[model samples]
Target chain A: MNEKNTISVATMKRLPLYLSYLQSLSPDAPVNISATSIAAALKLNEVQVRKDLALVSSGGRPKIGYKTVELIADLESCIGSEVLHEAVLVGTGNLGKALLNYNDFGRYGVHIAIAFDQNPENIGNCVNGKEILPCEQMPQVCAQRGIRLGIISVPQGAAQAVCDEMVKSGITAIWNFAHVKLIVPPGVVVLDEHIGTSLPWLVGHLS
Target chain B: MNEKNTISVATMKRLPLYLSYLQSLSPDAPVNISATSIAAALKLNEVQVRKDLALVSSGGRPKIGYKTVELIADLESCIGSEVLHEAVLVGTGNLGKALLNYNDFGRYGVHIAIAFDQNPENIGNCVNGKEILPCEQMPQVCAQRGIRLGIISVPQGAAQAVCDEMVKSGITAIWNFAHVKLIVPPGVVVLDEHIGTSLPWLVGHLS
Candidate 1:
């Protein structure tokens, strides 16, 4: 089967920014908004904003600009929010707990079905109402659920092992939060969510 | 002063990946390796690897490739790790605590000298030995310390107020983790670290 329409990764990253800003505005505040307004508010280029918005189904009017409510819905579909994703997280450390408590995930259609940890003290506990199961049960539970996305929040030493387990358990895509570079086999997608990279990128601009 | 040598943000993001990969390899293991080997290992293009490595001071030999040790140090300098940046973090929530405990920051020359929170119970607490102070003291302490980098890990509602306090106290750059797009007056750099964006980007690829 053919895949859905594609957007560049750079453009995909900016969609959430536009979505959140649109969500912040009152439905009564403006019937339509020009790309120029969004560009000014978000410090983005006007042409880029228009290009990104054009990827959505609904097009902007010549003078009235994009319809506010319709744009939000288009963005939601563009981001695949219509299809709720139930995934598993394999770490209950501080970052894992932070990801659990992060409320924004719900808006984006991601729900952590369960979290796994090796710590005996944390195994029986709960984070944001999601059970923290033993690492041994990860493969069984994730496979039984047919989960597709796996989040690796483990330490650098344990990240690869956890990723292998996730892939072995039927996870097709992995969102890695570990510091090290993971080696995943072919056909599996890995998104390295390295927060440290932002520092250098920001510093480069600051310099 | 003239700004240090420049590289594109895309190239800057990949430097850490190469650095970490190089750090994993033993210098004695390979006297010389070509960009093709590095590209194959990381699933990146050979030309891109060569292009990125060229930005560093040291040059690669025709067939021997770059000296691993020199490349590592050059990558360190490329990312500005040689200059340790002392910054402050506000919001000692789960995410804030995660940031404090993240050991990778030290390797990147980012030290969260202090963290601030409004929670009375957490004000006197500590994470990774760094004191968590009241928000009221942020301006004073940051001003006295001459802090230039501020990290806002607070909730959406409180992010702007925390950012304002940081700016008022002389913070010139901000690493914001809040879900909102902040309005910073000109001169202050804000890097919004949104984990949610990754989800859509990943989904876009998966679909």
Candidate 2:
């Protein structure tokens, strides 16, 4: 990771999505892509894409745009590529399983290291190529793996405890799906994906 | 619905969440709940609650506070009371099923009208108590049931078409979960809940 060219978590979050969009546009085309094209696909301003890309690199010529493979590789490095990031899932509900089945990670260098479920039936099963670890074994495995990002899909009741345990296990970021508002240490990041809160926002500008 | 007290969809979205938080708290305790307390529960501002509530009534006193139950009822009326809103699910993916199984809506007025799936195998069954209707039946069911809100949980590729169909069916608001930006008519509201974009905002704030 280059200390001089660090990217914000905000920019890192968009990389995978942007990569997916860009991949659809040009499969074997040259890596160089225009900020204008990326902005159009993501529905963001070209200036915004340029500003975000500035955090990563500007080696791509303004005429030729950014090199796709190079820019993606650059993004991975910006988000930390020296090591593979291990992700632990808490709450193997429908969403938990859905994420496990999502196979779009190899290119992004993100992998689901393990899954946790209190259900006795699901605890020993292999899900989406990853073994489902018991809830009791979560802390131990997380510590062993040095996992930094924790994904929470548990019910709202168990969400806070899951978050607390994730933080205690040395996790740095939490991608939360539980409808509960988690209480985390000041530095820990929590992303809420509660469909209820989100759906309305999407429709807010509609009518 | 009272014309003068027409609650904006934005305010309606928060009202149910607010009510849930208020109900989760002590019902017997009559202490005046302040905007700050409501804000803390939902991770919003006191002024937001005050302004949102202002659309309904100027009830909350300066320092003393708002009566929880009374405020909840008032907010409910402003959101909706008589005509129950039935919503059609445009895509039946994990996100769609998660929404179907979502039990929180029973408390609020929103009810799952039906779910539509592109796959024939999924078309005949019910998941989470909602029937999975064929995608072909969307326009008919939507018009028949007078559904106005369409939940777009389809893959990004199918988002635009389903949204267009929903709009043609007279739906004015769309809960768009597909990772694509929609070009919709002025009256049609498309609420974007794509975690890819929103998670960044949260990560940036915490980072």
Evaluate model 1: give its TM-score. 0.92
Off by over 4 Å in 2: A1-84, A105-109, A198-207, B1-17, B27-30, B37-57, B75-82, B106-108, B197-207
Task: Summarize candidate 2's per-residue lDDT along A1-207 as a digit string, tens digits.
Answer: 334224454465565556557657757776678888788766777887887776676566868888787777776555434444567888888778877876644333457788998889898898777898878787789778777778898987788888888888888788888766677877787766655753333333333
Which candidate's lDDT is highest?
Answer: 1
Q: Under the 3 Å rule for N, CA and C atoms, how many clashes does model 1 have?
A: 0
Looking at candidate 1 chain A, the ten consecutive residues that score lowest on lDDT are A1-10
B1-207: candidate 2 lDDT, tens digit per residue: 233225454565566567667767875776578777788777777788877766665568888778777777775655443444678887776768777877665344467779999888888899887899888888899888778888888888888898888888888878777777776877787766665444333333333
After superposing all C-alphas onto the true structure, candidate 2 shows an RMSD in angstroms of 4.8
Off by over 4 Å in 1: A1-5, A26-28, A204-207, B1-5, B204-207
